[model samples]
Target: MSAEAYSKAYIARCHKTLKEWGAPLDGWFVFNVYDCLEEANELFTCELCGCTQVRIVHVMHNHHYFERISVGCICAGIMEGDILAAKERERLVKNRAKRRKNFLKKTWEETRYGVSLLWYRGKRLRIFRLGNGRFKVCYNNTSTECHKGKPITDFLTAVHAAFDLIDPVVEIWHA
Candidate 1:
């Protein structure tokens, strides 16, 4: 079913059930949502609607119980005051980008080389300074090669070149 249908159904089903007691649906609050992944569906389910596509609601509270309710983005918006609104989403995105940029800047300034979470050719990578005033990048986290035993001349060249006898590997991101 469409997201709107899901939201409407969810609200219809939950509005009264939650209101019969002292607690009510309108009494609830949504603090934040799951940090989304690029290609993978977030792991969660909607607490109010029984929908399984929840983006992972951080909090669904009714003053008495602070519970974690996994609600889809649609449910989150319809019931919880547009937590997924375009403006909110844009702010979140920009905040994340700023934080990432800051992290990379700090890393670059403090140390020229270190283990990075960034992936390269589906492998975790490491950048370390050489004794010869050059930089080297290697797959340091796994039992691997493809320049595993070779010395890279510089950061950029190491990332782009198929050094030694290994095939050219792609860097996933600079940071």
Candidate 2:
């Protein structure tokens, strides 16, 4: 089948699976989408369990009259066995949000004058100043020759490849 068709079918299956489990769908968004018919696939992992066990309890497909519109549901594993209590869940969520905010701020700083994005022989590389006051390579955008309608995946792989070029002493965090 075509890639767009495959994406649609796969999303449908994910919805089905979540429905079968009666999972709560919250804080979900479309990670990315093609112009009309494809989306990058995402799997929700338990932040507490270190990934591997499924904690999804349901799926809610809110329909919108737009092409390529889809939702990615992230199931909070709070309902799982020996899961964190209400207070603990609140603390975890707060901490995660704080980290996410900090990450975004750092990325913005790097994207601004704090970092330099240069193109060398058709490859993009980033030179940034770390919080610790050190100049380093933050990313290298080489080997991103493959391009389909999957802009999300292509963009991510490029960013990651660039991150891989970062200096070992630099600590790069993501949200």
Candidate 3:
């Protein structure tokens, strides 16, 4: 189906769902957006529009409603009444995924002591393996001991986390 037709159908479904749930149709805000690539092989059904295979999930909440809904980008746009902003948000998510892929593909130099290192944005990026089977990422002289509740279990995950840490600085540098 064409984009317009798909969007119209999704919007219609969204409206119907919202009305059924007694939720406001146009005042929902996206609270979070995430890529479900880890579950890519599994089918994801949008709660509002019933669309399947939605890779990027947008969690939306309405001020007047207590329950939140998870939907695809189109349904999110329809609920929020701003397709352009939803598209823009999805674009940034895609770019972040690309950057993470590129980060893993970068030629990281390995030290004789088994440390992985790379130079990014004039800062020395380093990944060190801890004795407890965890990983630590270092930028310049500062090192991150942990990444919130997520444990860095391997070199690749550490590198990805490093990208998450450094990409913000990269954006600031560009700005």
* Candidates' C-alpha lDDT: 0.46, 0.34, 0.76
Name the top TM-score candidate: 3
Tens digit per residue, CA lDDT, model 2, 7-124: 5455455446545545433323222211111112334443222333222212222233122222211222122211233224334433443443343333322355755565543555
Show model 2 residue runs off by greater than 4 Å. Answer: 1-79, 85-94, 107-175
Q: Which residue runs of candidate 1 sit more than 4 Å off their true CA positions? A: 1-3, 6-8, 17-22, 36-42, 56-58, 66-68, 83-87, 90-175
Count clashing residue pairs in model 1.
0
Query: Worst ten-residue run, lDDT, model 3?
Result: 166-175
- Return whichever of 1 and 3 wins on TM-score: 3
Better of 2 and 3 by TM-score: 3
| Candidate 1 lDDT, 68-132, residue by residue in tens | 45455555555555544623543554355344434344322223335333443454455555577
Candidate 3 residue runs with Cα over 4 Å from true position: 6-10, 38-43, 168-175
Better lDDT candidate (2, 3): 3
Candidate 2 achieves a global lDDT of 0.34
TM-score of structure candidate 1? 0.41
